[model samples]
Target chain A: MKKTKYRSQSGNAFLVAVSAVILGLIGGAVLMAAIGSNPFMGFYYLFRGGLMNIERIGNTLATATTLMLVGLSVAFAFKTGLFNIGASGQMLIGGLCATLVAHKVFLPRPLFLVVLVASALIGGALWGVIPGFLKARFNVHEVVATIMMNWIAYWSIYYFVPAYLKGPSLETESASIAISQSLRAPWLTKLFNGSYINYGFFIAIVCVIIIRFVLDKTTLGFGLKAVGSNRWCAEYAGIKVNRNVVISMMIAGGLAGLAGLTFYTGYSRNMQIGVMPAQGFDGIAVALLGASNPLGVLFSSLFFGILQSGKGFMNAMTSVPPEIADSIIAVIIYFTATSVLFQRFWDRIARRRGSRRADQREEE
Target chain B: MWSTLSSIFPYAIAYTIPLLITALGGLYSERSGVTNLGLEGLMLVGYFACAITIRLLQDTMAHSVWLLTLGLVASVVAGALFSLLHAFASINLQADQVISGTAINMLAGALTVYLARLISGSGNVRIRMGIIRKNIPFLSKIPIIGPLFFTQTYWTTWVVLAIWALSWLLLYKTSFGLRLRACGEHPSAVASAGVNVHRMRYFGVVMSGALAGLGGGVILITYSGEFHGTVAGLGFLSIAALIFGQWKPLGILGATFFFGSATTIANVSQVIPSLSVVPPVIFKIFPYVATLAALVLFSKKSAAPKASGQPF
Candidate 1:
């Protein structure tokens, strides 16, 4: 009976997620039709673009790597009942740190990689911790604080890149890092037919496993979840709610930092000024769809990665703009935000099913 | 320094008007117990709608003034309609207002760009003409105040300030305003008093959408002649101003103007010899940094609406 109850509960969540995705796709279709584009053809090219060749698959995975980390970052915060909307700012700071390390540091390859990754983690954590600290100490809203942090990072990059890291021709971007210094693994590149796949994919997988284990098996995880469910109750039960909030934001920021590292050094091998990585906000959709679970984030990130990686091809093949992918993602998030509508629909179905089962038992 | 001050004053006011109107919109929403974090998105929707309306009518219209007036109306309508999505989710659907607002922001950013790309094929809509800045004849002749406030000002600036004044009176001096504020402070009590909490919140949210949309339209007419799919974070900046102002009408006026001055100074510092000694980044980041500082200082005794962010 307990197992059935758990199954049904999971089933309800799954249904909600699926419905949101369906509605979002329909919304995208309507948009496409309104613009006089063939919706079916657009979607076809979009999926094929992400999966047509081994190289494309590798690119998709490479894209998913950054998204996965960002998703985990958002999901981790969700677990502690905190919203880390400053992931973009955290990513910028982390990427800046990683870029610095890539340019200036010259240790042995393995040692260099360790330092590179750690720099991003620390950078992201520092950025994340400021808002966390503000929220904990001063009761400031993290949402507004994070928004401010995003702009600060944006303007800082606007000046810092031109002053310190200007590339050969463009003043808008940093100098590219050499492949050896980047997250590129020769073996993986060769395996994927010279695609952009890098060591960040492995890092994402490891993070997923570690996060899963921590959330399910550790006392710290229990305390965090307790605080998330009910902070007042958790405080009464001897949990340090403020400390948990800070720690949660820190870990979340660190994860987002890794995302930045993977994106800047591994996928692109450079950073561009004036671009707020949309992946940060896309991560919110991933976490929401994943139901804020580690495993759920992994799969959802991969799904979004396909859409993101495929969009350019769709635009090339059809009159549809590449922003269709983003529009769809946004629609999906809106539906997810209004999931209470889905909950009612699912509840009504469950009630009917339970009543039918009761009738069957009476007949028996 | 004095010459620079007068030279910079008009631009400062131009920058402040958009933020002031948008932040005022935020004030209404928050005071009515809904945290409309999607003000940025709503502004974008207005910005886009105005751009499209003006773009379509520019060739057909004889007078630019009438064309611009119609464009602003389109923006207000589009903004109010778009905000209904946020209102429905946050109010009727009982969704988390912050998440819903975030969704609104993302949707506006993505959807506007998508539609713009389809319409213009380049994702940017450029207008042939913008609102001409002119001196208020008699007012411009008033020694110090004239040159600083009345000269070279966009007509939209005065319109927005007029709206601000009217909003202040409506929010402070009316029974309806009292009820709206009451809903934010104690919705249950307001409900018990026979006020429709949901209806009042909807009105507040819609008002925010209209004003924020007008703010976006003002930005396009006054300084930006192109719709390039972004307000460059002005919507978010206005939100910070809303907070800095502690959700008050007069306070928002001051806060937005402060941010506006900082922004104008940052923008023009490259050309101004006296200010060029200071790094442009410091000026650019000043408003955001000050907002964070303001939040920290005021959080101890925050005047945020009591029922704000809570779904009715």
Candidate 2:
């Protein structure tokens, strides 16, 4: 009976997530219709723009690659019941470190890759470790600390990039890293007209798989999950909860840093400072919407990528500004975050139905 | 030395206006247990709303000061209304508070840019006649202190300080203050005593919206005296100030002034002959570095409300 009830609860959770997405899409369509565009055409364009052409597919995949890394970053923290809001700051620092290594150091491609990756990991891990340490030792709320750190990271990078690495001449951007190139896979390079369908996508996929493996198969993962479910219980079970929290944060920060590298080295080629993209915060929504599952994040990140790529076509085809996509995403997240409420509501109905069936059976 | 001190005073006050107001806004929400990350978004909307309203009513309002006042009121109303979206999602619908706040931030950012373009018929809009300075004759006539305190300070600075004092009184001295604190510290206990948790949270969020709006208004009318896409990040700085202030109204005010002074010093050091030896960016980084240091030092000892992030 307990197992059956648990299965029903899982079923209810799935139903809630599906319904929320459908409701969000319907609301978006209604908004498009009100804006004087045909909803059908808008959706058609959305799919076509995101997937119909090779270049578009490549762009979608490229965008998804960074989002996947960020989603993993946020999910890793969430698994340990920590909200790593500093992912944005960590990503910025990592990007800065990667750029400095690539631009300031001269080495063979293989050695450079190792150095850049190490710098990115160390930079991001240091940033994440601050909040982890604070939360572990001082009981400081990670949310407020991480949020403040983001601003510090942003302005510090803004100051440093212009002062030290502005190519000794330029006004707004740092020098492009030496040997920076797109990470396109061989088959994708031919399939996508030389678009940046790079090795980073594969990296993102591997990272996701590794994260899932660690969470499901490893003792460290068990400790993290146990701590996330209940700190006191995990501690009573002989888990070093504080260490797990810090390790989880370090892993999360490393993933976000990799995201920055994927963007700079695999796509943009320049370390653009001043404004880190909103990928870190957006990862929160992606993680939640994906239910914090690594595989779920892959699909959700792809969905977000589709929305981003489709926005351009949306602007071209209608009077709607591309920003309408952001509104749609906000609405979806707003609903997705409230999915527990929906699950409860559905479970009550299901229970009522089950009870009535049992009553009928007893009467017979 | 006197001249340098006097020159820096008005600039410090001017910079403090937005941060002071927004920190007070954050205090309202946080004191009632809702952690308003949407303060920045609310401020952005207020900034755009004030700019567009001022642009439209500049002729009929005749005086820039009145127009500024009108813009402030409009922004406050708009901010309160905009924050209702967050309050509804987090308080009523039981969504994740952090994600709801972030959603509001993204919406505010995209909406501000979209609205600015729609209103100005372009991507950017600038005020024609910025806020005009006004002085009280008697207050402007004192000795060395007068120039620093009264002569050059904008009316918004005084208003901000007055609001800060008012918030302190309301939060610490009144029955409403007791109830609000009770709600934040233990909503279930407050509910058991027959007080409404949802209503207090709503009130808190709405108040945050209004104050943040005023903060945005001050930035537009008094400091930058214009509206742009880049203005969105100042609200985040205000959040840092709130935390650095340790979530107290008076502390927030002091932190605001500290940050304001830091910013002014950074800007002024670039102009000083002796200090010009240092790169301007170092000065630019000073406030953020201070924020980081303050967070490291003070946050460990600060006692946040018990129910601060919980959605109850």
Candidate 3:
């Protein structure tokens, strides 16, 4: 009976998410109609734009690769009851480290890649751990700390990129890293038919699997979840809540750092200053939609990836504008994030149905 | 040297108004027990709405000040309305406050941009003359402080100062203020005292939206001179001020001034040769670095209303 109750609860969460997405879509369609655009054609072009060609599919995957890691980062932190809004900052730091490595470090090809990956992980973890430490030691709210961290990171990049990695004739961005130094390999490029798809896609998949294992199968994951559920109760249970908070942030930061590596070293192959990564914030929505589950995040990241990549094409192909796509995505995220209300509604209905069935049984 | 310092004064004052208003806005909600991370988003929505309204009214309205003032009112109303999303999610839905705020921020930026695109055929809503500076004939002739504070006229500066005084009075001197403060520190106790916690929180959040909206509109006409798709992280800076001020209106005002000076220095340092030894980016980073240091120092000693971020 307990198992059945748990299953139903999870089922309810899923149903709530679905209903939210449907609402988002309906709301978006209504907006489109209000704007004198045909919602059906707009959506048709939106999906087709994302999936119409092999190169487009590859671009979508490439976009999904960074989002997947960032989503996993946020999801992991969310599970531990941490809001890691500094994912973008961590991504910047990690990407900066990898960019430095790409320019300065020369090793055998495989060894170089390994070093780049490690530097990114360490850099991101450093960014993540500061807020974690503050939250643990000083009881500072992680949200405020992380936001401050983000600006600090932004300025550091603004200073560092131009000072250290300025490209020829361009003051805005770093010199393009050599393709050999980046995640893009000849074989993978050929397999994708010269698409942007690279090694980060596989790395994201591996990270997802590892996170699922850690969250579901490890004692550390259990401790993190326990603390997330209730810090005082977890302490009473002999779980060191402070220590778990730090660990959760570090792992989350490391994941976001990997996203940085994929984005700078794989997808774009260069770094730009003065832009906060949109993926860091977008990952928050992705995590919420996925209910902060590892596998669910993996899938939702791909879905968002489709929406993002398809948005430009939809704007080009239809009367619907580009900003409208952003609005649609934002509307979807808003609905999904508030899905707790929907869950409560579902729980009430389920309880009523169960009570009614019990009464019917008694009457019989 | 005093003259140079005075030259930077009005600039600092101009920069502080929006931050002061927004931080004060944040204080209202948090003091009533709702952690409003959505202030950043609320400000953006306010700015966007103000810009659109000013643009629409420029031809219809006879005077620029009237148009700008109307825009300010529109922003406040819009901000209050938009903040209802956060209030609903956090209060009624029992959603995580941070997540709800994040969603609000995202929704505001995207929704505003989308609306602008639909209405204006461009993502940017712009106006040229809504921002104005005026001088009081007698007040402008005062001493060293008068030349510093009175010059380079933006009405937002004085307007915000007036609001600040009023808000301080409202937060400290009134019976409603006592109840709002009580709700944050102990909602259950407030409820037991026959005060409705939900109503107080709703009041806090809506008032925050209104003030923050005005803050955003002031920025559009005063500092930015136009509306882009973003607030350029000024919203987050206001959040920092709210925390640094330790959630008090006067404290937030001081914090905003401090940050305002930092930004003033960053903007003017390029022209000051002695200060030019350091790269511009270092100055650009100073405000954020200062905020972090302030948070670290104040975090442990925070006298925040205990029930902040609570669902009740």
Candidate 4:
């Protein structure tokens, strides 16, 4: 009976997420029509662009890799009641560390991969820890702290990239990493028909599994969630609230760092100095739509991945702007933020159905 | 050094006006018990609206001043309209204010650019005319103060300063202001007193949207003559200022000026020989770092409204 209740609760959450997505899609359709384009054609081309062929499928997964990691980062942070909006900055620092490793470290394949991944993890963790420490010690708001940290990272890279890793001509981006040094495996690339799918996809999957395990099976996860639900209560329960906050932030930051590693090293193969990775912001939407669950994040990110990866093609094939994808994401997040409306609606329906069933049972 | 300071003073003021107005907007929302992180997006909506209005009207209107005014009005209207979504979610739906604010930012950023691309075919709207900078006669000649404050100023700068002054009065000297402040600190008490907390919050959010839009329009007319679908994180910077200022109008004036000077210095450092010795990164990161420091200093006795992020 307990298990069934839990299943039903989870089912309710799923309905809320689905409702949000449907509303978001409808919002996108309204926008498309407002701009005088046929919404049907725009969506048709949009989906086709994402799943039309093997290369596109590979591209979709490649894009989803970064989103997956960032989504996990955000979802993990949300579990601890922290908003790690600084994921973009964390990603930059992590990608920079990973990029540096790709450029300078000439180890054997397996060892090189270890160093690359570790560099990003540590870099992201360090970035995450500062805001966490501030929140713990000074009771500072993590949202503002992370935002400041992001700009600090931004300017640091604005100078750091040009000064050190600049490509020969383009001053705006780091030098491209060689295919051998990047996250790309030759076999996988060939299998995907030369698409940018890399080992990062596998890394993201491993992280999802690990995160799920930690959240469901570990005492630390319980402590973090306890702290999240109520800091004062968590303290009363003998959990170290401050310590959990810091640790949760660290893990979240590290996940975002891995996202950077995948994005800069695995996918783009170079880091652009001025561009704040939009994936950081999109991760919030991913976390929201997924209800901040690890498996939920995985599927929602793939859904967004299709929208993002397909947007350019949709633009080329139809008059719909590629930004429609971003607009859809934004609308979805708005709906998710207002998911209380959906929750109340669903509960009313469920209660009505239960009442009807009880009446039938009484008659029998 | 004095020459360099004098040279950059006008530019610094130009930069500060937009930030000041936007931060003031944030002040209203936060003081009314709603933490608005959507200032950046709201500013963009205004910026885009102003740009589109100006682009469409510039050719037809004989007077650039009237055209600019129309553009700014459009921005204010658009920003206010856009903020209604945020107000609805937070007030009516009892949504997570931060997430709702984030959604506002993302939506404005995307929707503005999407529409801009369709209208202009370049995702950028450039205006042919801008408000020319002019020195106030006689005031410009008054010693060191004149050179720093009154010389080579855009009229929009003075106009924004007037709004800032007016806002200070409205927030501090009015009965409605007391009620609004009460709503942020203890909404139940306000409700008990027969003041509608939700209505006050809506007014605060709407005011924020209008001022932030005006701020965006100010930026378009005074310094930036184009709309590239972004205010380049100035909205966020203004938010930082709002926090740094401890949610006070007078405090915001000072904070925005400090940030404005830092930004101007960062932009011109390479050309200024003595200043060039200092790494540009220092000036670039100073405002954010200072804001963090300010947060640490204020956390124990935080002036933030008690119910700011709380849903009543």
lDDT of 1 by residue, A36-128 (tens): 989999899999999899999999999999999999998898888888788999999999999999999999999999999999999999999
Worst 10 residues of 3 chain B by lDDT: B128-137
- Model 3: per-residue Cα lDDT over A1-364, one tens digit each: 0000001126766787677778877877887788888999988888887888888898899999999999999989888888889999999999999999999999999999999999999999999999999888877778778888888898889878998899997899999999999999889888767888999999999999999999989999999988887778999999999999999999999999999999999999999988888889988877877778988888888888888888889989887877665566667777776676677788899999999999999999
TM-score of each: 0.97, 0.92, 0.95, 0.98
Candidate 2 positional error at A364, Å: 6.2
Global lDDT scores for all candidate models: 0.90, 0.78, 0.85, 0.91
DockQ of candidate 2, scored on C-alphas against the true complex (2 decimals): 0.43
lDDT string for model 1 (B1-312, tens) is 889999999999999999999999999899998888898899999899999999999999947569999999999999899989988998899787877888898999999999899789899998888898899989999999999999999989889999999999999999999999998888999999999999999999999999999988888877999999988888899998998888899999999999999889889998998988989899778888998898888876778888888876
Residue B177 displacement in candidate 4 (angstroms): 0.7
Better of 2 and 4 by lDDT: 4
How badly does each model clash, as a count of residue pairs?
0, 3, 1, 0
Stretches off by above 4 angstroms in model 1 are A1-11, A360-364
Judge candidate 4 against the unseen true structure and give its global Cα lDDT, from 0 to 1. 0.91
Q: Across the candidates, what are chain A's individual TM-scores?
A: 0.95, 0.90, 0.93, 0.95
What overall lDDT, based on C-alpha atoms, would model 2 receive against the true structure?
A: 0.78
Candidate 4's C-alpha runs over 4 A off are A1-11, A362-364
Deviation from native of the Cα of residue A300 in model 3, angstroms: 0.9
Q: Candidate 4 versus the native: TM-score? A: 0.98
Off by over 4 Å in 3: A1-11, A355-364, B62-64
- lDDT ranking, high to low: 4, 1, 3, 2
Q: Which whole-number lDDT from 0 to 100 does residue B218 have in model 4?
A: 88
Please list the residue runs of candidate 2 whose C-alpha ends up more than 4 Å from where it truly belongs after superposition.
A1-11, A30-35, A167-170, A178-190, A352-364, B59-65, B120-122, B230-232, B277-301
Which prediction has the highest DockQ against the true structure? Answer: 4
